[model samples]
Every structure is written in structure tokens, then in C-alpha cells.
Target: MDNPMKSSFWMLCILIDLWPYVEDNLTQLQCNLFSIGPGEYFRSLVAQQKTHLWTQRNLCDSPNDAHDRYISNHLFAQLVDRHCIDDRGPIKLFCDDFRPQNIIVDPTTLGIKAVLDLEFTTAMPSQFASEPPWWLSLAGPDSYLVRGLTLDHFVEAYMYEPRLDQFLAAMEQAEKTHPAAEHHKPLSRLMRESWRSKRFWFNYAARKPFDIDDIFNDCLKDGNASIESLDEETRAGLDAFVEAKMKQLKAYDTDCARHLESAG
Candidate 1:
């Protein structure tokens, strides 16, 4: 990271070579020669991996509402997987932990020092990379503490538009100068459209499984998708599943309490 040629600027230069190829079948074939898999294959592979990971976790991962967490994970994982059916891939490296504090800066000169925390980086769906970052040094809609804000009132309650407009204007200016952005649509335009189309919500909810139930219903869902209003297909046997799941969590909680007592 200290090397001038190995900075974030050069890391992003990979896109300059990739954009002209993403939408052109002939160019994509040329890219495959360099070991960049086609968009469709990469998307499908990531989707399968995500689905398997989702199934492996359940109420145990989130104990607050075990039954709801277990069911929502399965149901929403289906919707999240559907996002992968498109040709919009050749995945891009993304970092969910990207935020202000992670980027160290020289306060006197107002220059970035180094980008830390590369551990969270992964090859993710293209949209996840293009959509505007959710961590804008503010309480994102997902982490809002106001009553009712965590429900469908999320986006509206965040009071996001004024800041978003300012960010987009700056982004539009930056995109005009970025070499990689020339072949692709302006990232600012894509981000505004991503927000408008709610693809941003899908991309966000797809990553945060612990908060998926609230985020999916509040932002991603079209209408009532709660356990009570789920379609018959997803609703079937849910009642019994909830009952069995609650029992498991009860045992889990009891074991934790017993261990705490022993430790004392």
C-alpha cells in the first residue's frame, strides 16, 4: 500500500480495462482469455455460494426473535438469489466494511494516507460495487434508532435526499474525470437510478443477513411480506417451524445461562 503504483488509484484501474468488455459479447470473450469468467457464470456461482451460506445459518445466529429470523433467512435468501439471474455480473471486489474511519488521512494536507481493512473485501455482484455506499458517516437507514424507522418508514425517515443530491453532484463531476468511467455509464447516474429503482435496497439487504428481516420489509419488499402475510407457498408449515425453533432457542439460552453461572 505504500508503493505509489500499488495505491487505490491503480487498484481501480482494473475497471478501465474491464468496462468496454462488460456489455459487448465479443469483448467479453477476449476477457475470458485473461481468465475473467463471463458475467453469467460468475453471477450464478456467487448466488449458489450465498444460498448455501444462508442455509447454514439460522435462529442460532440471531437469537432475539429466533423463529422470525430462521424463516426470514430462508425466504429472503430466495429473493436475494434471484438478483443473480441477470447478465449484470462479472463481479467486482467490494468491501461491506467500507466507511470513513477506515481511511486514514493527513489532516494538515487533507490527503488520504492509506486505505486500511482489506479483510472484508470480496468479489460481489456488480451492483453492490456501483450502488452508492451506504456508510456515508451518518446513521444509515438500516441503523436508524427512531421508532417505526426500522420498518417500511426507513428511507423516508432517514431524510436522505438532500445529502444524496449533494453527493451525486460531486460524484458526477468526479466520474467525468475518472478514466475508467468513460466507457461505462456515469456512476452518479447509475447510483441515482439504483436508489430510485430500489436496487440499492436489494444490494444492501442481500449482504446484511442479521438485519434482513427489518431491511427487506422496510426497503426491499413491495407490500406486506411479514410472516402473517407471506404467500401460501412460504407460509405453509411456518407456524409449526416457529414452534419448533422457539424450543431450540430456549435450550440455547438455558445453556448460556448455565455456563455463565459456572464461570462465576
Candidate 2:
């Protein structure tokens, strides 16, 4: 296993490889970024994650009403997708789970032997590569939603600002220590900009659908998170969507129960 603290450097190395495709006309020494084509991928994943959420009966946290959450998710999806919508983005290979567990190492020398879990590894907009990794602080994007809590409820307790500063600081050190190229702009600078610009949160939610609401409530916009915030037509459509999803989940659960009974 790798310590997230030490492994932060390892991730910086990976990000260097995640750099965008540079053309011969390289003029900027900065981490120029890109995003998903039109951002449909994220909106779609929100639907997918919602289906999984209800199907698995994972509604343990009651910090907010489920219907309100659906509305929050729906509203946020519209806002969040914009973050990932750059058509000119260069696609680069990346693995979302580029963290400690997938890294295998030799105990004696502590050298990495292999990296596993490549199923979801694929090309993405290079701006995503600039996203500050979640594991660097060991505070996953799953923090609020998975626990039935909002980030507002637990963020201060975690001293998130300080930990985040430390992570970025470490990333900067790693960048200086390893020069992928002298002309390249600093990756650490790009990462901090990601945080400040909310690109980190949007890209995070894009890849992790379940955390969309958490990020929306905490990062993109705050309080007064009500269905009233949405337009009438949009609200009506979501009501219908939720109604349809409920029936679909019911059917899925029934099928699963039947399969279990038949096996018994």
C-alpha cells in the first residue's frame, strides 16, 4: 500500500504523462486545458448514478429529502455540464482510479511492480488531467453524499482548506523536482487554478455522478437549494423523470429478489 502523502508525488508523475497533446507551435509554458465534448457525458452519468443509488437502497443519509436531492442533482447537472464542454480539448489517456490501492510494489525495495484496474482507463479532455487528485488529501469526492452528509456539515471539521493547501504545495514541489520539459508551464499552477475555478469539483462530479449534489451545494452555489430554483417546465419534467425512475427501480429490485429465491 502507498501512503497518500508520499504517493502524491507519484500522482504528479502520472499527471505529467497526462499532459495534453502539444503541437509544434507550442507558445505557452502553461497547462492549457480542455473538456468533454459538449458535456453530455456528465449529464448522462448523473442519471446512471441515480439509478444505481435507488436500486442499491443506499439512502442511508437523510440530510436532505430524496426528492429534493433529485431536484438538486437535476439542476446541478445542467450547470455542471458546462464545465466539461470544450470542443477544442485534446484527448489524453487517463485512469480515474489512479490511486494507492491499484499500485502494487515490492516490499523490500518499495518499487512499483504493476498498476491494476484499467477497465475504465481511457482518453479524456486534457483539462481533466489538470484536476487536483482526490487522494492527495485522502478526502475523496465521496465525502458528503456517501455518508448522508453535506460538505457544509463536515468541511470545517476536516480543516479542508489547510489540507488542500498542503496537497497543492506538495504538488508544486514535485513539479520543480521533476522537469518533464523546461518549456512546459507548471502543472501545480494549473491544479491550483482548477481548484479556484471549480474545475476540480466539476470534473470530479463528472467522473463521480453521485457527488454532483454535494459539489453543487457546497462549491458551485450555496444555500436556498430548493426546487423553486428551477424553472416550471424543468421542474415538471423532473417530477416525471423521478416517477418513471421509481417504477424502474421497483422492477429491478423485484427481479433481483426473484433471482435470489430461484437460486435458493
Candidate 3:
């Protein structure tokens, strides 16, 4: 099927080329520059050659890093032409699997920190039954300037949605061996429990906790993923649920603080 969007994009580019004076509009110039032609020649060149340039320039020796840089460079180059902000970086959209968050403690202050970011923009819907990538400021110590393991790297990791099965398996293992195992639970189980636990407030209930599983399976049927990929709609719904739950939890915490202050 022809991509009407792609065709429209090319048409816009041609229009821009025909009227270069329109370059006065920075945004229009950006769009024209990034616009992939009908033949996709520039895009192909970036995919095949300039990608190697980025890889070599960055000294990205890892196969994964090289591939990610290539994609990022192509996407970024497109952004330069279109003058659009592409928040999704190379690592986030390319990584295949991610491990469950293992909390790290700051030795000096004894502060416990969770690695997962509270907000993550998802792609490919694979994180439905698994824990998404988390961010970490340090590696369980006061270490600084680690190679590519910074807060920025953490956010980029989530762009490449990891498989649900892989996330689930990590959660299972984490629940067994992680120091904070109590915080670990399968994503599906967590959702069901949250639904169950908040039934009084939400004023709803599934026939059983297992019903959530059935619903997930049914949703997956229409989705273009393996057993592990979450459909975009499902992921979005899950994100909404999470946001609501977070708000509820915050309210409860506030109430508890008030009660304690009054008691004291």
C-alpha cells in the first residue's frame, strides 16, 4: 500500500525546492531539508553510509551501539531538515531487551533510589507485562562519568520497547534475588492487583484476577506483536491507569501525613 503520508511529505519537499526563498521560514526549511524524496535516495544514503560515519566517529564498537547510532543519526538528520524536536533517541528505539530495576543505595546518605523513570514514552507496546526501563543517577555508589550509563542514557533506553516476556522473566528472577524483592511483581499481576485493590474507589471488579489475563490475550489477538508485544492502545490505557493510581496513592499519603500530624 502506498503511504499517502510519505507521498504528501515528498510533495511538500518538492514545493519547498521550487521556492527556496521560503527558506526564510526556519520551520519550512527544516521540513524541506528532511523531507524524504519519492526515491528515498538521501534516506537510503543515510541508512547505508552516513550511519557508518556516525558509528565510526562515535567509536561505537558494540554492534548494538553502532546500529542505534545509525538509526539515531538518520532520524536526527531528518529532524534537522524538518526543524522538529525528536525526543526519541537512538538507544531508546533500538534496544531489544531490558532488565528489571535493581534499586541502588547511596552509601553516604543511605538513600534508596529506584532506577525506573516514572514517565516513559513507549513504542511497540512490548512493556505491557514487564517493567519498563528505569533511570539511575549513579551505579549504587558515588561513581561519576561512567561510559554511556548516565541519566540521559536511561531515558533513551525506553524508546526501543523491550519484549514483554523478557521483562516478565526478569521480574520473576528479581522477585527471587533482588534485595528489594518485595517491590518486584509481574506487570500483568501488578495491574490486576491494582485493579483489585482499588475496586472500592473505582467501583468495579473483574470476575476474577485471571480475567485480566484473558483480556490481555484478547487484546493481543488484534495487535501486531508476538506473545509479548503490547498494542499501542493497550499501552496507552495502561499508562492512564498508572497515572490515576499514582494520583490516588499521593492523596492517601497526604491524608496519612495529616493524621499523623494531628495525632502528634
Candidate 4:
């Protein structure tokens, strides 16, 4: 129970056990409670997130902010297109605030007895679940940056933890036993690639609004060559879209400030 590695592995196993149930029942639950299809849901969610980020002033103030915004919007559009074309996998069901504080664990056995918060739990695109959970750090990704540690450094430290190999082995065995093992196998691979390519930041950013600026900056640094390789028309479109969005956001913020001033 005192062993952190054992505790983490057990938590991972719990997640593995819960995933299939969530995936299998998602459609039925959606039908019973709401009627929107997953594709439409994804589009709406992405659009809303984009709008929310656009309106936040401090998120895009870095030196490479323009390029970062351009890359983020373009990558998001591509992600949307890809998911729209083949939105066949099971949607990810996760709690937004998945942290140790919310988990009730047995001190003697290091087993999770109950998960407390169900309010923030929801389904998202399977790709969102492809990467490792952010809760591993017990803090937001920005906290690492504030401590002068890169995301890669954080990941490296996590990987070096004891019994990580055993944890991964258990995960692999669990995946093999699942009915949709083939579909789930890609997530394991994607998780590794995400870490290596710094794409984990993008996945992280997708879920957390405040982390977008830092993630976007990291992505731009890591994928600069790939971004540059994009076709001229595509790049131009991305530039125009981001420019317009920024203008709209600034106007909205200004209007809000003026209204507050008048009221005051």
C-alpha cells in the first residue's frame, strides 16, 4: 500500500476494467439520455473549445504565439477531418478532474475502493484517451514548465518510476483480454509516439484550456518542419482562420470591458 508504483499500476488496471464497460454502453446511454451522434458531438465540442481559447487573452501572448495559434488551429482542423471520416472507435469516457484526491483507496491493499466525482465524467473522441492521463503528475502540465522542467523531462521521470515495466505488461495483458483488443492496441502505440513526438501536449491541450498556450508552443517547436512542409494553400487558410478568430476574440473582450466600465 505504501508503494507508489503498485498503487499506480492498480489504478491503471481499474481504468482498463472500466473502459470496455464505458465503450459498450456509450451508445445506449447516449440514446437514452441524449440523441446527438458522436460526430456532431465532437465537432461541437471542438468548436466550443476553440471559441473559449480564442477569448482568453493571456493564452496567446508568447513570442511564437502567432505561429503557435496557427499550428494549433490547423492541427485541430486536421484532427476534426480525420475523426469525421472514420469516427468508428469507442469514445473515451473519463473524469476531467481525475486526481488522487478524488480516489478512495485502501491503505492496506492499495486498491481503489471508490471513485468519488462523477460529475465531470463524460465521453470524448477515442483519440483523446490515446495518451496517458495527466493526473500522473498530480498537477497541470504548466506547473512543470514553471518549475523549469519540460514535458519530456516529466515523462522521462514518470517512466523511470519503479515497476513501470510491470504496469505496462499488465496493461498489455488487459488489452489482449478485451473483446476489442485490435481497436485498443493503437492507443498503446499512440501513447508512446505521443511522448516521443511531443504530441502528448496536443492531446493534453485538447482537454485543458489553460494549457493550450504552452502545449501549442511545444508543438510548434517539435513539429516546425512538418508545419513548414504543409502546402501553401493550407498554410494560408490556417493563417487567415487564426487571424479572424483572434480579431473576433479581441473585439468581444473589448466590448465586455466597455460594458463593465459603463456599468461602473
Best by lDDT: 2
Give the alpha carbon lDDT tens digit for every residue of 130-167 in model 1: 78777653655556634445543344555566668888
TM-score of each: 0.65, 0.62, 0.17, 0.56
Task: For residues 1-264, write the lDDT of model 4, one tens digit per residue.
Answer: 387755665455446434554464555455644545556655655665555444443344433565566566555645544334236666668677777889999999999999887898887656666665565556656678788877665556655323334455666677676635443454556655555555555556666655555565565343444576566886777656557556755664576556546645
Q: lDDT by residue for model 3 over 1-264, one digit each (tens)? A: 987865665455435333433333344335555444422422333343332332222233344443333333333333222211122321122122233354466878878755444344323212222223222222311121134243233224433223334554666676566444454544545534433333211111011121222222222122443312434553344434434445544554465456546645
Ranking by lDDT: 2, 1, 4, 3
- In model 4, the runs with Cα more than 4 Å from the true position are 1-46, 57-59, 62-64, 79-86, 146-148, 157-166, 173-199, 219-264
CA lDDT, candidate 2, residue 243: 63
Residue 127 error, candidate 2, Å: 2.1
Per-prediction backbone clash count:
0, 2, 11, 0
Candidates 1 and 3 compared by TM-score, better number: 1
Model 1 TM-score, all chains together: 0.65
Clash count for candidate 4 is 0
Residue 27's lDDT in candidate 2: 25
Model 1 alpha-carbon miss at residue 122, Å = 1.8
Q: Mark the regions of model 3 whose C-alpha exceeds 4 Å error after superposition.
A: 1-167, 179-264
lDDT of each: 0.59, 0.63, 0.34, 0.58
**lDDT string, candidate 2, 154-210, tens digits:** 446566667778877887788778855766568878777787887777787667655
